[model samples]
Target chain A: LAKTTQPISMDSYEGQEVNITCSHNNIATNDYITWYQQFPSQGPRFIIQGYKTKVTNEVASLFIPADRKSSTLSLPRVSLSDTAVYYCLVGAGRGSNDYKLSFGAGTTVTVRA
Target chain B: EAGVAQSPRYKIIEKRQSVAFWCNPISGHATLYWYQQILGQGPKLLIQFQNNGVVDDSQLPKDRFSAERLKGVDSTLKIQPAKLEDSAVYLCASSEPQGGGGNTIYFGEGSWLTVV
Candidate 1:
């Protein structure tokens, strides 16, 4: 499993854009970047995943550069409901018995008024 | 489609006390996982099960933790004598078989445990 590093916390106001970057310099070719979001009492939900370049979902966008060493998660038009802890993980493409995923201390994003 | 289901939404126990959590994965999902999430930290994998067999458990504290998936559908995780540091939320998650886009995992609302 590839180790990942991300910010501890970030803050943003309503309707603003929030971007969180994760660094996985030792990422392997088979590793993919996945992000999860956790609200107060809910389980962490999958946000977006990307192998390279960029991938956008209904909720967020993932931007990866050519090096594959880093990736950024962008949330547009943020709302207070978006306040949550976001985790960035690097792992082998899912469902492989060898893919033992690990989660690092995530970035807690606070979207205030 | 139904999501993963877990029981005992919350638990409070003393140090050295035992506790257990249960989970039922989505129908037909073959991969299940147990994770521990301490306050203010990310969820950490404790064990993984492929069907009724264990796949990974290196991170699980064998001295206190044991888990089983019977019939490859429902699973149970038990701590024989939880410590103060064992106070954390136990999460149950399941994923479908590997597909083109990588199987995305779905998590159940965790079982929160507090040891005093």
Candidate 2:
């Protein structure tokens, strides 16, 4: 399992773009980068995932460099409802059980008016 | 489709008391997992079950915590002689384990346990 490092907390206002980056210096070739969003009292929601390059979804975009050592999660035009903790996970592609996720202290994003 | 289900959204018990939590995975799902989330921390996998068999349980506190998935459907996690450190949200999740597709896990509204 690869360990990830991210910011502990961040503050942003509505309508602004937010980018949270994760560092997994020892990421493996089979490792895929995924981001999850969790709100108070709710289960973590999958936001975006990518193996390399850039993958964009309706909710967020994931950018991974060629080395696959780091990835960034970009949320556009955020709203107050987006206030939550964000976790970055590096694991094997799909259901590869060799890489179990160990979530670190996630980065809590506070979206204010 | 129905999502994963968990019972007893909240539980409060005194130290050394026993408590149990239940989970029902989505229909047709073959893999189930239990996680413990302490306040201000991300969820940690306590155990993973592929159907009725245990896949991984390295993080589970076997001394006081026990879990079973009878018939590979609904499962129960029991904690005997609970301690203050055991106060956390117990989450249940399920996923497909048959093959290639990225099996995004679905989680239930976790059961919160508070040991006084």
Choose the strongest candidate by TM-score.
1
**Per-candidate DockQ versus the true complex?**
0.65, 0.54
Candidate 1 lDDT, B1-116, residue by residue in tens: 99999999999999999999999998999889999999888899999999999999999999999999999999999998989999999999998746765567889999999999
Q: What fraction of correct interface contacts does each candidate retain?
A: 0.63, 0.49
- Over the full model, what C-alpha lDDT does candidate 1 score relative to the true structure? 0.91
Per-residue CA lDDT of model 2 for A1-113, tens digit only, reads 88999999999999999999999998877777878899999878778878899999999999998888889999999999999999999866666643356688899999999
Q: Runs in model 2 with CA error above 4 Å?
A: A97-99, B97-101
Error of 1 at A60 (Å): 0.5
lDDT of 2 by residue, B1-116 (tens): 99999989999999999999999999988888999999999999999888899989999999999999999999999999899999999999987733553456778989999999
Candidate 2: TM-score, chain B only: 0.96
Candidate 1 lDDT at B94 equals: 92
Q: Clash pairs of candidate 1?
A: none
